[model samples]
Target: MPTGVALHDVRGQLFDAAERVLVREGPSALTSRAVTLEAGCAKGVLHRHFADFDDFLAELVRDRVARIDGHAAALRESAGTGTVTDNLTRVLPDLFDPVAVAVVSLVTSRDGLRARLREARPVGVPILTDAATAIASYLTAERELGRIAEDADVGTLAPTLIGAAHMLFADRQGVPPEAEDIGKVVNAVIAGVR
Candidate 1:
């Protein structure tokens, strides 16, 4: 193992490596050694940056979660412009990207990682829960605009959409569902409220 190699943005490199490992090999293959190897760095480098493997995994999850905040903002912003179904259909692919799906699996499979994440994310499964919240907020904005039914329950609808979408995208051997297929799902879920 090479020591003292100058690697810029080590944390980002390791995280990106971890995501690649997760997406390609699934959670069982994720380890400190795997991450460092994928990053092409000395194993000690990972320890130098993170307290431990679980800590690194937790940070990786938090990093992904922060992305949802940005997506949520953009989804909320598109509340009144496009068709309700179109707005939602566009966001699902992003929210359920290969890395995000693999992260959800990693978090669920690792007891330590899940416990560590509870400090920052006390409720809901890390990425999926946040995605649901984003959907709920977008639906709420639509309801306010009279695009969604006034009586529609955004709370229930949000999770329902997330669960439905998750099933469609989960464990697909890398091939994503067609946009038209996803649009049909979005339409079916929100049809009652539209």
Candidate 2:
């Protein structure tokens, strides 16, 4: 086994490699062996960092949720300056990234994995809900500022837009929307709010 890096660094690398594996090969390819190999670490490295596959999976979900939450928070902070459509367009792609989609796909999959994923639900839900709230708040502020349609139902509309963004990428058979397509959707939603 090769070793030189600090334990925390090694652990971080393994988690990042796990995300790549999950995104590129789906949840089935997320074994400790695969992650260690991808990270160029010794076999025991994964064991040292994670209790077992279940713990590793939970951490992966947690990390992804944290990343999404951070990104959403950043978007909310910058939202005030952009047009409502601009703000939605900026944040939409982050929702559709391969890692994020893979996490959701894994959660909806069969028995054992689904059960393990359920254990992380309490961790994941609030992150997403907070993201939704940030989006809704941005829209509400825009509406108040006379930038968005005065009558726009910011509450329902914001989440629906976020859901649609996720659906575009999650639907495997369907073509995902491009930036322009997303802009169109945001525009339509705004129009409806008007």
Candidate 3:
């Protein structure tokens, strides 16, 4: 007798394949046929798993955002032991690293993929903003404890700092900061709080 698999199992495999294709070939290469082929299934397999390519791409963005949010949560949970700057230094590199840059570039470029990203915006924005807020909150706490300048505008500063990290990682101009260099930049930004 032949073995059988559940529908959800097959659907998960299709999504997994779509992720690999998006990560490896960028958004332009993602198509129903491509994803089905990558998943080692019939052409209709992708449609059965997803209503269409747009649906697949939407799920992809959601999945990536969730992963990033989870990482941010882990960092936030461990942030108590270190200085605000120290915790940020430890976390930003992983969040805005080269692989993440590549993923962002792909998602933001294709129209269908971009629409999916927009659909996921409600979830993604809060995840990203929460990470920024966590950093800002840490800064605010440090200020209260007298470790940082009392008048510092952490609300504005945190997003600026995160934006800078994003730029550095996405710097296609080939002048992106090294990890140590990013540390220096972050430290300088935090130090200028006064």
lDDT digits (tens) for residues 29-144 of candidate 3: 87888877887777766676678777776676566556676666666565446666667777887776544565576666676666666664644443345557666766676677
After superposition, which runs of candidate 1 have C-alpha atoms over 4 Å from their true positions? none
By TM-score, the candidates rank as 1, 2, 3
Q: List the residue pairs that clash in candidate 3.
A: none
Better of 2 and 3 by lDDT: 2
Which tens-of-lDDT digit does each residue in 73-104 have in candidate 2?
67667655857677788787776676777777
Kindly report which residue stretches of model 2 are placed more than 4 angstroms away from their true locations once superposed. Answer: 1-8, 110-131, 144-146, 149-151, 171-176
lDDT of 3 at 31: 80
TM-score for each candidate, following the candidate numbering: 0.97, 0.78, 0.73
**Shift in Å, residue 135, candidate 3:** 3.7
Candidate 1: Cα lDDT at 148: 86
lDDT of each: 0.93, 0.71, 0.67
Query: How much does candidate 2 score in TM-score?
Result: 0.78
> lDDT tens string, model 1, 1-194?
66778999999999999999999899999999999999999999999999999999999999998999988999999999979999999999999999999999999999998899898778899889999999999999999999989999999999999999999899737589999999999999999999
* Candidate 1 vs 2: which has more TM-score: 1
Scored by lDDT, the top model is 1
